[model samples]
Target: MANGVERELVLLFSEEELREMSGVKRGGEYIEVTCGCTSHRYGDAVGRLRVFINGELEITCECTPGCDEDTMTPAAFEKHSGRETARKWKNNVWVIVNGEKVPLSKTVLLKYYNQASKNGNGSHRSNNGRVCHRDEFVRCNKCNKERRFRLRTKEECRIHHDALAVANWKCADMPFDK
Candidate 1:
């Protein structure tokens, strides 16, 4: 919409070109770093972003569960944004596949989550000033008991998962052999 018109072709913008485009920012690679189409208030006819805690990013469409997500490089993403494609990644808006608007479901994912809650499949998390992971599943050979090392759901599961992939890690749950 640089000229107040929606182009039929996706525009691959250089950093300079993007800086001049609407709903673009100056601090990202491939796609817009600061914002995406899903949450853009300016009505960007492109995909939105979801930056993970580990700095990974994903381009998500404005649809509910199981809806197709558009994946492409920055250039291809802009190309598909054309009105002719029909699969539109409108900013802060809904997705339009083949000229059909894809509505965001208010209960699809929520329904599954509610079911998970009722089953008690993910409702136990206790910290004892140390790690509190499920020991029953991974009982140690020496103690034949569950060891706490940071795998609880409520605790920092993600951080622990990342940190555990190291070459040197001493298990506090492991008893010192006397």
Candidate 2:
């Protein structure tokens, strides 16, 4: 946005999809779920995925040191990419269709927000306050804006974060180059 507000996209999924990720398990806890071993553009595997008792998902990107780490609502965890064949487990928008996976609009996503759930994702940015970096968001004090830098190297994000933390940067300065 011109104002520098990050675009927060919270995906939604079907109930069946949640069951698939969680495998019809216990309740009220973060159950460690297996995530794809796909090699991220930056580095290693995609890290871990967890489902809360209330049907929320927590994902961490094992791609890099400062990779992805965030929680998703049941709705997002259940969305089927509609492109999967044998349900190749994913933590993002794509879910399994033959089982549980479907798209829901903003109104539709919010509608299900009120449903009772254990360890639920909670609002899941149904309002705002979600980041947008590495698939998660990062902030910049100098620009007074928070957005993705798309830094090529893992060190870039770390440096950018450090610069921001130490207030050693100016909005006019580039974190490095491009």
Candidate 3:
């Protein structure tokens, strides 16, 4: 009964017929059907069909003739449309996640790229003296090795060395101080 919604005149199918056709059991506790048309003003017409089940608002599928089956729950739909999540970066870029600029692996970056692209901004590095460029790897201040710096001060670094020397530091626990 909402605006833009129309009641269809299609014949109702029996529970057995619906089950056989779509493998979904009908004759549940609740069922409601609603339809509406989207005014695009350009391109093809878009229609919506909603089905409620068990007294709960359920499936809402969009129909445009050539469109694919893009049916989902409200939570999933919002996440896919980049409306309820943060942007994700891709390709081992330096990104600030939870206030730390860390090198994200390629796998992590790909998962959030599309969402980030829609949010009007790309991945950003934190301002805690961490490198921001994707190609620039972090180098240790003492050894110049391509290792992730843990933001330790000179005093902390010295303490780490002393602890290791006392234990005859094993390679398994090289730089991390206890």
Whole-model lDDT values for every prediction: 0.36, 0.39, 0.33
TM-scores for all candidates: the values are: 0.21, 0.25, 0.21
Of 1 and 3, the candidate ranking higher by lDDT: 1
lDDT of 1 by residue, 31-137 (tens): 33322333223344445543222223345443345546565532334343443343332322233333443332221111111223422554444444343355322
Better of 2 and 3 by TM-score: 2
Span of ten consecutive residues with least summed lDDT in model 3: 2-11
Give the Å error, residue 172, model 3: 54
- Stretches off by above 4 angstroms in model 3 are 1-29, 40-54, 60-62, 73-178
Q: What overall lDDT, based on C-alpha atoms, would model 1 receive against the true structure?
A: 0.36
In terms of lDDT, the best-performing candidate is: 2
Q: Give the Cα error of residue 141 in candidate 1, in Å.
A: 1.2
In model 1, where is the ten-residue run with the lowest total lDDT? 106-115
Residues 1-178, candidate 3: write the lDDT tens digits. Answer: 3221222211233343223221132223322232222222322222222233212223344444565646654333323333323233122122233334333332122222232333233333455834343222233444545543332455644545454354333333445547
| Candidate 1 Cα misplacement greater than 4 A, ranges | 1-93, 103-138, 150-178
Tens digits of per-residue lDDT for model 2, 90-152? 333322223443322211222333333532433233225553234334555666676555534
